[model samples]
Target: MLHIGNAQIPTCGGLTRRSFLQVGAAGLAGLNLPDFLSMKAAGAVDESKAEVKNCIMLFLVGSPGHLDTWDLKPNAPADVRGPFKPIKTKAPGIDICEHLPLMAKLADKYSLIRSLFHTSSAVHGSGHQWMMTGHGFNNGDPHPHAGSVIARVFGQKSALPPSIILPGKVGAVGDNLGERAQTAAYLGSAYNPFFLGADPAKSDFKIANLSPQAGQTEFRINSRRKLLAELDAIQQQVENASTVAHDTAYQRAFSLITAPETKKAFDLSEEKDSVRDRYGRNTFGASCLLSRRLIERGVRFVTINHFDTVFSIACWDMHADGGSLNNTVQDYERHLLPQFDQAYSALLTDLDERGLLKETVVATLSEMGRTPKINGKGGRDHYPPCWTNFLAGGNIKGGQVIGASDKNGAVPHDYPIDPPRVLATIYQGMGVDLDQVMMPGPGSRPIRLIDAEPIPELF
Candidate 1:
């Protein structure tokens, strides 16, 4: 929580999120939030024709095994099936992991894409680049994230950034080159997703970007604002894209930092204790709840990274190597599965109850799927050849499985789907005319946001 002015937004423990961000002893120009808040040139699109107005993307950082989770091959050999059992859901013929009982109950709300696969390198970074940006960056020309594309097309609807990444941005995941794909590359920093550096789950959490430096009084911050205005006057003479971008960033930052309503939007204390408990009290759960609040307050896109890295911590990367990369079925049964089941289902129910689901799309994605076969250490490894991802709400039809995996859950049995098509479906579901809308491409040329079309079956 941050104390912006005389007003204070408290946490559940009665701590305040209201405080001046001590940007740095150097100056306010070093404010990192404004840097990510920079706006790019808005894309060409007819807003009146759009179907979906908002999206909440839950990105599972460490890819979960499709066989162990959604596409269970019960008849397969003992070695292939793992420990989890599949249970029937509300959606006919759709079964999920037993650990995900809550999500199983709401199966009618989301549609699973079981045949999702990519032929790119089998690295975490490459998968992240493909799923997050809809393009592989091995060729060097990186594309903007899906949220950045939305920001470029729809722009901001309120003081909040058009696109936001909750908790924090993706950090080291082995392949730094591919992991860098989370940013808005050719689309420019203006369209970059705003990363919330602090975790909302923590009682002591405070928005670092909103607070002024330690020992700095409001008078000093205001004086710096005046100084910045003077500097802007001198810089205005240039009147180029860079100047316009910085000007817009500063304006957005000041507005977000000073607005009471914007501060309230970040306040979890405003929510009922039962509501918070329903979403779960962990990092991922709090993020999901925060996403709903953000969408309600006019954020166009909100992406929740379930975990920042696939390291020593318990995550979906169940390599079971008996080392730092180890994560076994126990982790899934005890933590990962239940956490996701609770938070995801709560998000769907909350959004639908608030009437936001009809206009907002919720997407569950991952870097890739784990190996179909169990490993020597009782876990699975990364396998980019096949996986599962799903979409719900908006105009997307539910109670249906869009594609299928083979008996062994190794590859697509029918109607294989790829990453770009998924991104296209999201954009199309949001009501963007894929054929009519074109974003500014590399070198200021007009081009479609994605090369592939939306999956017709999804609609």
Candidate 2:
């Protein structure tokens, strides 16, 4: 018998126990196998009554103003209405910002939720935690992201991870904000989303984590796999739940490193020049394109963050302070709106043309809506009292508004929606039964996936 970590391997059939143990022990310490195993678990996807097979979430890092974008107030005063005018869409009675002309043309493909409000603090992080995870971090009991919970419930669809966040992770927005909101939390590390640390728009783009280090070769990789296989064989003889879970994780890591399809999935070059051009060559555009590729390749969920930080960058957080975080209305006109309109419209049209729209739900989410009234610096401040987000494709009814803001776009007028309801709608759209499906909670006890019910009107 030979020992490797907490498991034992049998060597009597071939080499001596001492030599086998020596070789196994030599390189195992550097493998970092436990962390990989802790990141994923195997479960069957229950698609018996699912309306959609996948989802692509475009997270607008900074919140957009309802009055300026979806819920326009044309009759209001200059400061209130700002400068942008609303344009008619294909859907009658629906109008959006003139800056979003492309989106207006496709209005019938999605629905807007204008009455979304939250009671939490009006901070960027609070909204991120609420919108991303469906629940705010309570005490130290952080909830897993909606995507992570989905990954846990449905499991992986293929060699690709179940849930993936493109471009990079959100960071440096505010104090005590970025912690654990994007992580797996109590669901354990296995359900955490795989973040593409590098920007895909770069010409020399490559996933650093996926590529092998210098001097590492396929031959050496295979040899390590062989050794792990022997160790796994021994463990199976005395298999327990934990051991089985570890095996699944190790197998996922092995596949990711060696599979040609894995590399092909991340390759933007495979896309035609025309298609890439349509998506634009910028970071957000490339990310949107890559998201489609990933969904096509079997990833269950893909999230594209429009901007990772609001500091010194042109983002949706239009606080026209004329300082470091000086994003203004001009930013929306020249950069933000155009960039979003191009990339987002391209994604919707491309998905529809490929016949993916029916099986994939595209959602545009943000933390909070900007203040209804413009600030002193000619920008809108954070407003959690009211905002707007939207959904399209799958079973979501399009060309209609689900809720509304007041005359001033300050509060919900009717059909008021909250963050949890939005998340519940997404879960239902993805064919998940919130009532029947449960995930492992704080202890190993099974708990309802979400406390809220799906928005019935979406169906």
Give residue 199's lDDT in candidate 1 (0 to 100).
Answer: 95
What TM-scores do the predictions have? 0.89, 0.88
Candidate 2 achieves a global lDDT of 0.83
What value does the lDDT take at residue 257 in candidate 2?
A: 88
**Cα deviation of 146 in candidate 1 (Å)?**
0.9
lDDT of 2 by residue, 1-459 (tens): 432211223433666666566547744854233332233256454455565878899999988888888999999888899989999999999999999999999999999999999989989999988899899887756888877887777778788888899899998787566467888777766677889899999999999988988888999989999999999988866634456555776777787889888999999999999999899889999999999999999888899989888898989989999986799889999998999999999999999999999888898999999988899989999999999999998777888899889988999999889899999998888877676566667764556677898889888
Evaluated at residue 33, the lDDT of candidate 1 is 30
The per-model lDDT (C-alpha) reads 0.82, 0.83
> What tens digits encode model 1's per-residue C-alpha lDDT throughout 1-459?
421111122334554323223334213655233232232243223456665788988999989888888888888988899878999999999999999999999999999999999998888988888889898885677889999888777777788888899988888677775656777777667667888988999987678987667887767767777898899988977655566566766766776666677778888988999999999999999999999999999889999998888888899988999988889999999999999999999999999999999899998999899888898989999898889999998989888898888888889988899999999998888877676566667875556779998989878
- What stretches of model 1 exceed 4 Å from their correct place? 1-51, 215-219
Candidate 2 error regions (>4 Å): 1-40, 48-51, 227-247
